[model samples]
Target: AYTVRESTVFYVRVPAPHARFATDLLCEVVGQPRLDPADVEIERGVILGELDGALDTPDDVVFMNLVEALFPGHPIGRETLGDPQSLVAMAAADIAGFHDRWYRPQNLVFAAAGALDHDEIAKTIDAHFDGRASGVRPERIAPGEALGSDKSAQRPIEQAYLALGWRGLTATDPDKVALAVLNHAFGDGPSSRLHEEIRERRGLAYEVSSSAASNLDAGTQTVYCATAPEHLDKVRRIIDEQIEAIVTDGIDDEELAVAQGYLTGSMLMALEDSSSRMSRLGSAVLTHGRAIPIFESLESIAKVTTDDVKRVAERIFGQQHVESIVSPDGDEFDDDDED
Candidate 1:
């Protein structure tokens, strides 16, 4: 059982005579057990293959490029799966140390839910973790370097995926709710601004939308579109033009009302699922030290004004913010030319 701010993940693993209690337990041993170096190499190879698989997908590659640009110097910016060179450079000791530092009892929360008896789970956890000493705090990681280059490529993919992004408000900012509502209107679902402008009106691409990334320290909002090789440059220009329009004329009353309703509806729907509720609780705990009730978030969304959305957009989508472009190997069009 593991408990977060307002949620929990309970686990009950039966230990057997020859079976290890946990795989990460190896890191807890008093001394470095003689590990076969060959086995480590094999595992590294498997991970490398997985990285290759992710890169092979166009959408994944584009999003990873965005992350690299958005979080240039940060660990969160670091690929979830480290790059080939980075993985190859890792020693067995490094893996052991990382596991020991991050997987400690103090860093964990035991939680249980559903029909399970709380006392029995608590007793089991106490039996297993009672005497275990807390580990040292993990070292803080630095911010990722911001994306600067106008163009990037992973050549083998067939389609071109592009993103024009801007830095946004942090999760705790008062305008976060406003920003979410704005983003929903701009490009959240099929009825969004980008979808209406780029896909429906002009047939620029098969898919187009915008989204926001929110966290305790910072946040970002991006307008993204995908088009075929022949239509790439036009799609980029259209996206930029639409963004400029949003910044200038501001949104109309009708658009604002639509965005408000859609955002409110989405929020209401999100809470209907148990897993989402649990996730909401856990994320609040992780990000803000406690969970914010569902009603609290809904109220925030409902109260957002058009002026608030416009102000957030102006602050977030500034000219100086980061930009990223990823294309297939030998494209003639240059993303930097637009700058």
Candidate 2:
């Protein structure tokens, strides 16, 4: 499977015995893909179908609307799956050109995890990938300043979907670890402030969470909730209150410890899978320019203090946010609507 975000990743899982074969196959696909015109036509229809499905998904629509508001005329704001017009207009040559421009030896990183010899794998990669001219890395254009905005759409769905977005730190920012901790305590899990206050205590929402998506140059912090239309106002109010409290008072020591432990444990558990380990290795090198040891990552989380969390909260949550909502009523719930 392949995924596209700030970076594009293509991966496959196979038995340990076929590791070399998998490596060769991956190299062939990445380094020299034949963008056949007939195949492109077929895949275009597949992507269009995917686009229709995404549009029908309330969660996808709401989050994408939030991103559009956050980035506006930028490429980051556009749907990853090209829109209907773009999909129809795109040709095999367009795809081939894109592949040639971006898929360079210097811009790629090969990573593997399993019972494999490092030297043997390295030699195989060199044999397949060496001798190509090291191409220049493309310079990235950062998105401009984002202003706060609100958007709403009506859907036939029973429950309302809402998303709140704010501009966030870059992947390499010094404060990323603190932001992670804040995310965990704020809305990541059942113990998070959002889940506890909005779902467990108030019963205003069935699902509520927050996430941070950091890229090479830009990032986003978002909070999402699905709730009844009548409860939308209360849910928004509770989210605002939580943000204000965290920004003003910061998280306490116990909350800090819990968030830290949760992050560390989650990391350890995820690394147990060879695929996850391979992803970590590749993504770390691609994003940070080197592989960061697990211990180093854990230590960074451990060093995050209450002040760190509060400081990051103020930096992110204190800013104006973009809001997107999809509901039966295509309008924001008024404060007066709340009993």
Candidate 3:
């Protein structure tokens, strides 16, 4: 048996519930999905086509290349849409091996929230998957080191899209709540430092933000910005200056209070809907082995002080990070021209 979660945010203006929860009943589809070899080959071709399409977009190319450099040999770093060449060359056996290794029942968890009963789910799981133990728990692979600051390509576009990353906490890390709050204060939304500094005050390009890419075993946090090629140096300096400021000065009490309030409020608002709640519950169960109660998680965020944020900043930004610059491929740009 398996569970699929559809976590969606329902706007107040929409007719959908704040959150909706539905649990699927799957008895026969317990292990690796069964697809005919012909179908698999067809799907593989489709994936390869999509990868080609993505390569046509400069932004997508930079993003994918950054990930490739960051994760190296790790699956997380692996192309979400398999490498077109490798995928096209894959034998049927390769796909089957990947499935057998990652699709075991023990390696998966079935969960649902937002209008579902635990008892019914337990019964369904018992009926379908309990008795037929696959008897194998595949060990998950670890992610590789963060990539260095080398820019792989130079493009002739007017604007440069830079993707910078830092090694971040794993999904199960106890510091996740603190890191979430820190991220909010730094670059999550409009009120974040990256936005306020890069957009509102300085009037650079219109986008700047940071995000956490967390998985069961590991996570990464990245800050991204887009600016005219002429202003790339300014943008890079601003980012570095901000990181330095955070690490040394830390946030004041008022800033801390504000970040805490916004993060906690956002968390509460997110869970107010059925779909969002279901997603939260499902993700927690699948990733952390149990659902983290929303209230408790918020309380943890509330406890984060400026010191914690600074400490995290120091640890994260101190590492070798990846930088991807998207411009015309033939452009000859002096990467070290930054003042």
Scored by lDDT, model 1 comes in at 0.66
Deviation from native of the Cα of residue 242 in model 1, angstroms: 1.6
Number of backbone clashes in candidate 3 = 11
Computed on alpha carbons, the lDDT of every model, listed in order, comes to 0.66, 0.87, 0.69
lDDT of 1 by residue, 248-312 (tens): 76677777788778777877897775455546665677667676876787778778777887887
Task: Score candidate 2 by TM-score against the native.
Answer: 0.95
Segments in model 3 whose C-alpha atoms lie over 4 Å from true places: 1-34, 91-102, 141-149, 154-157, 333-339
Which 10 residues in a row give candidate 3 its minimum summed lDDT? Answer: 3-12
Off by over 4 Å in 1: 1-43, 110-113, 116-123, 139-147, 333-339
| Candidate 2 residue lDDT tens string, 186-284 | 999989999999999888988999999988878999999999988998899999999999999999999999999999999999988998999999989
Highest TM-score scorer: 2
Candidate 3: tens digits of C-alpha lDDT, residues 263-309? 77888899677657766876787676688887778779878978888
Comparing 1 and 2 on lDDT, the stronger one:
2
